[model samples]
Target: MSTLEPIQVGLSNALLAPERPLPPGVITWNGSDPSVRFDVYRNNVVVSLTTALAEGFPVTRALVGERFFAAMARCFIADHLPSSPILSDYGDALPDFIAAFPPAQGLSYLPDLARLERARVQAYHAADAPALTAQDLACQLANPQRLSAARLALHPACIVLVSEHAIVSLWAAHQGQGRIEDVDLRRAESALVLRDGDAVLVLPLSLEIGHFLVALAAGAPLGEAAEIAAAAGPDVDLTQAIVLLIHYGGIAAWHTPGDL
Candidate 1:
């Protein structure tokens, strides 16, 4: 290891693990104790990171009380320190962490909720794109048969999520848009997340429609996607799903397979 590697490693360890001893630097004011100073710095760093996690997963924090969330966040931080300098990019692994976390096992829907929160954060920071309009779709699909062979380009900030739990309803309840009292927890939920202007919107999707979108996002042609949606269920609502995608700025562009 290089001469400075040990110091860097030692500093990182000292900051995240309170039990680790401070690095070999002996400098202090009048030879005062270094552990106290290090402890204060370490606490501040952990607190800031924990607060960031709370901000990223407000619903999760609310689902589990603040104290419990903080404890979980601390464990997550110790195991997965930020590799990037950007704070907004931190906590990307939190959803996966929560999925396997012991304390969170009782809250089976927590991971999906965390995924929704993560999607929101990613959409907020994603590169901007002008959404394709209804006119654009009409023009592109002027020949209805051509649509089956055409691939629709989704918005740069769009994310489609499928969860076995009614996570969208749960998310909306926490955001004050819907009432938790009315939600049936056993019902599965799907969603389309997108950012238009400065706002991030999460719209619930029918299971079949959501599967269709998944296919589209995976580069499937419109015809095949529709087929997938149809096979998922008899009531796919192809028309309404198309309208919703166009209305919500989900499509950015599209082209037939032969266009390439």
Candidate 2:
């Protein structure tokens, strides 16, 4: 390491920690005390990151209220700094952090809500691809044997989230779609998040459809994925699932054994 490496490390360590004394070698133009300046910079950095977290997880913040969310965000920031310069790329670990956070333990659904919001952020920034049209999918899966063995490539923005809590309803409720009081916190829900044009949509899915989509996303063939969904729920409607995918432009491409 160079001579400045320790200085850089010290500055980085103290940037998010208000309790730490100012790192050495930090000087202002006036040659006055660096402590006050350093403190201001630290507050700006923490507040900027906290704001990013709030924007990324609006529903999560609304659930806990601003003050509580800010406190939790400060705690999260002290440990989890940005790995990438992109503001949207930050807070991927917030869901896991909330799961382990002591004060947030009472709201068991908050973690999954964070996860759902994080997925929305990721979906918004994911790469774009041309989705397959209904006719295209129909043509590709015309043959029964080929259909059984066919593999699908989902859109890059496609994401599936399954949670034991009513994350989909909770998130939608905050968006003015429904009443928060009407939502049953204990109910399990799954969501399919996909970017259509410029809008990111969060569509509710049945438990069986969630399993099917999860299996498909993992590269399972159609027949095998359908079987998994059936195992999860006996009344798995493969046709309905396929229709949903086609309607939402979730299927990017399809490949048969020969193409594979």
Best by lDDT: 2
How well does each candidate superpose onto the true structure, as a TM-score? 0.93, 0.93
Candidates' C-alpha lDDT? 0.87, 0.90
Q: For residue 217, what is the lDDT in candidate 2? A: 94
lDDT string, candidate 2, 60-127, tens digits: 99999999999999999988988889898999999999999999999999999999999998999999
Name the lDDT of candidate 2. 0.90
Q: List clashing residue pairs in candidate 2.
A: none
Candidate 2 wrong stretches, greater than 4 Å: 1-3, 27-32
